[model samples]
Target: MGRKKKKFILGIDLGGTKILMGLFDRKFGLKKTVKLEMDGNRGEKFFFNKLIDGIEEVLEETGSDLSDLVTIGIGCPGIIDIYTGTVKVSSNVSFFKNYPLAEKLKAKLRVPVFIENDANAALFGEQQFGAARGHGEVVGVFLGTGIGGALIINGHLYRGVSGGAGEIGQTFLSIPSVSDFETTRLKVGALVGRNAIASEAGFLLLRQKCPHLLEEIGYNVKKIRSGALSRAIRAGDTALEDLIRSRSRWLGVALANVVNVLNPELVLLGGGMMEAMGKIILPEVRSGIEACALKPLMKALKVVPSRLKDNAVILGASKMACEILKMTQK
Candidate 1:
């Protein structure tokens, strides 16, 4: 009798500022990982090259080759055409408009490739192995450079027509103005995303003449990331904390609306911003939901942070890849 060969899949989570790749066995155990900075401003060639480099590095580190891989899955921060493996448009990475990423990767590696929106992947990961395990209805909202959302209904991913269903960040809200009868409307992303927090913090620091933060990050708005912002808060930057709380409350309101509409069984929050500042932000989010969401819905809903942390997307991608492989075999 011959020994059974090991099967593995490559799962890649491509974010706005970082690219994470993991090699996983058939049971979804991570065997190796590679992380690289993603420069979205650099254009498609640079991005593609970096992705290829990361994959090769992981394969080399794990003592594996393309022939040993079963399939490749990518979770990208963009609007994906899942049926065709094309990226219709990506707000975070502007160069990927109408890009046939799956076809390109398949042609290069001679392996089946699957691509999905990052938030959706994360949700799947959570449902399969993380916080939302065993839940049939789940909604995942990831707070990063921009907020991303995904929906799982009746144990299946709910990708709407055109694969653009879970765009919670783009949902707008109208608030009545104090000075007039008119109401002001704003996109949820503009009010609660990481960029908004960073912008507000930058303005506060500048106005308060706080040189420490500017000095720490070379006074570059682009460089003011979640870690920097968290450090600032930990250093007793009251203004920054206040700004984050205010924005997080609005995020909660946005999520409250989602909970009301979807009536999901579980709501999972993840991404860099949440991972870094969840302790500070989650309370406000909970409060906002309590204030706005239907009482019965709130009673049944479980709002929790992602247990898988940073690996949620990659694991989800791996699961998707494995499922695709099974389908092909069948």
Candidate 2:
């Protein structure tokens, strides 16, 4: 009898500071993974070259070639045109305006390519195999350096018209007493993002003349990352804990809006921020939702932390590649 040929998929996740490429089997289990730092300031060519190099490294490490892969899928952090595979605009990576990413990759690698918004890809991953498994309607909200969101409806990703529907971070709300003169509106991203946490903590520490947080992190505000903040909270930094709690309340408010509208069965949270502080933030988020969201919607909703963590987007992309390959085969 002839040996059964191996079928695999390649998945890439492009984020603000890093790129992850993985080789996956038919079941979306990772065979090999490669990580690369992304320097968005280095221009598009340099970044694209790094992506190609990472893909090649993973394939070589796994003893697989491009021919062994059915398709390649990329989860990009931007407004993506799924039909054209073009990145319209990326807030973190500014150089990717109207970039035909899939076409470029397909040309270089000679394989079918699929592109999707990174959050959407993560949601798809959860739906296929992670937290949202067995749920038809789901909402995924990832808290990291920035907040990102995605919607799943009736077993399919819901990228609304113009492919930019699930941008929950961009939700706006009025802020009171910014300078004691006038109210101001700000995006939820600015209020709850990791960088925002750092900035707000720094400002509060300096304003209130508290040095405990500075002492904990050796006086380096830049070191106030998600993990660092988690450690500080564990060590009884009341000021920092309060700050995180307030921000988490806002996160809950944002999520409540989503829940009230979509009323999905599940709200899966992922990303570094959630991984570090989900335990502290989730209950507060639930409280905020319960306070604001409609009773019926709130009753049916389940907010849970993602089990896949960092690999969610990559696996989701792999699943998407497999789906696209199936379509092509048909």
Candidate 3:
């Protein structure tokens, strides 16, 4: 008789825009995947319902009963109490505050469940199966609607006091509360987290200076496609090109400070903006690091794009869940 196939784990990546779930075998090969849109306006009832629905769909598609699964890991956006499996606050999904997602999933699914911050999951995913693999100290920097950062030290996540240690997106460029209130610079998240900022912000900052080369964003904001702005740059839109360049400059400024303090050996940049505009942003960011970073520390560091594509979070979640299960078994 043929050897039976080992059942795998379920991994979920829950974000503001969508929820992605996947089933992976013992080898971590993906067996099935599903994605669901999060209609933010519909409120919490619909959100949770859709979330469960996606899981159910994947379970059915993979032909693996919930009982056959080893464990489940969910990477959720926002502040979460990892020890207690509670979601403290999620700017993406505001309804959940100190919600015990792990306990709730365990009750309903009747399986072990582990929950982690999305960025941390993504960082771990990359470390275990993607870009930063072999590195002892690494930083995952993702630039999306807002910036997200996760720290991995000595091959383990560094969850500081209160599990909110890696909220790097909230890091400020300059508060400027002391003077020049009008010229005061606000972080990208503060200016553009709610509404689509890539086009609006990029246009407003660049259009008037060079209107003859390109028009404004043209209302392509509905789809939430970040690559469009970068696509414009590649197509030779001077305004957007300049905007991306400046953004990278600021990115360097912010990241240089990170390097000075943490001095991580590797920094992997991911998320919508980095994936879309990497070519434009990388040089400027590197220049800033070279200019401002401490010589010895900066020399030892390397920044690169993440290699996991879109599966990093899910894969990382599965690995963590599997590890937890093994520890419990021992």
Candidate 4:
């Protein structure tokens, strides 16, 4: 008789707007996945309840309740304590403040629970199972509402003393400006959410150039995405090209700083805007890095697009769960 397939762990990627759950085997391959709305209400009560509902649904759908799973891993959009499994602060999801997330989930499910920052989890997931799979040292940069980065060193994640290392997007790029007094001030470039500027700028440019798109998409052009901007750029829209160019310049400079610091074997770019702006932005980013970076290290790294796409975080959470299980057993 063939050996039976083993039971798996559960991985949850809880973002600001969505909750994605997946069942993964020991090897971290996803057996099944389920997505549910975040239902961003007021406080912890509503958020936890919504999470409970989603977990129950996934367990039911897979016919594998919490008792059968080895452990659970969660990725939340905030500052987290990987050692204590606590959520410290959250920008987009406010209810996560000081929440004992791992304890609460453990009590409900009666299983070991691990928590990590969503960005770190996503980076780990991509390195283990997605874009940076083959490399020993890798940096994963996620550009969306904000920039998030994860670094893998010697095939293991390098979580700094505070477990908050690799926040590359927060790296500042100073642009020199001269005032009437001849004193110079530096204007920081694009520190806001990458998606925010892309969507907003893309909408404005589209409104000026492609009013027909507004008519076709019901003028809900505010809902425009980075891919749509790329399509417009390819279609020879001058405004769209210019908008991408501007974002690319800012993003390139910021990433160049990150490259100079980490000097990882590879840099994997993921998130909403990367797909649209990657091709146009990476060359310029490389140029900026070469212009500014240390000569020897500048030629060593390669930046590329993510292979797993949107599924990176979910898979990473699952991989984390598997790792936690290994630790517990030892």
Specify the highest-TM-score model's number.
1
TM-score: the better of candidates 2 and 3: 2
Residue lDDT tens for model 4, 20-130? 888877777677888887755567788888888888888888887776677788887777898788888766677667878899888877888999888888888887777
Clashes within 3 Å, all models in order = 0, 0, 0, 1
lDDT for 191 in candidate 2 is 84
The sequence of per-residue lDDT tens digits that candidate 1 reaches over residues 1-330 is 975474789999998889999999988999988999988888888888998899889999988888888899999988899878999999878778899999999999898999999999999999999998999998889998889999999999999988988898878766546643232236787778888777777776668644556667856778788888888778777777788888888888888998999999888889999899899888888888888999999989878999998999999998987897788789
lDDT of 2 by residue, 255-304 (tens): 88888888888888898888999888888888878888999887788889
Clashing pairs for model 2 are: none
Supply candidate 2's per-residue lDDT for 178: 61
TM-score, cand. 1 vs. native: 0.93
- How does each model score on lDDT? 0.86, 0.84, 0.77, 0.71
Q: What's model 4's overall lDDT?
A: 0.71
Ranking by lDDT: 1, 2, 3, 4
**How do the candidates rank by TM-score, highest first?**
1, 2, 3, 4
As a TM-score, model 2 comes out at: 0.90
Give Cα distance to truth, residue 142, candidate 4, Å. 0.4
Scored against the true structure, residue 226 in model 1 reaches a CA lDDT of 88
Model 4 residue pairs with clashes: 145-193
TM-score versus the correct structure, for each prediction: 0.93, 0.90, 0.88, 0.83
Candidate with the greatest lDDT versus the true structure: 1
lDDT of 2 at 230: 87
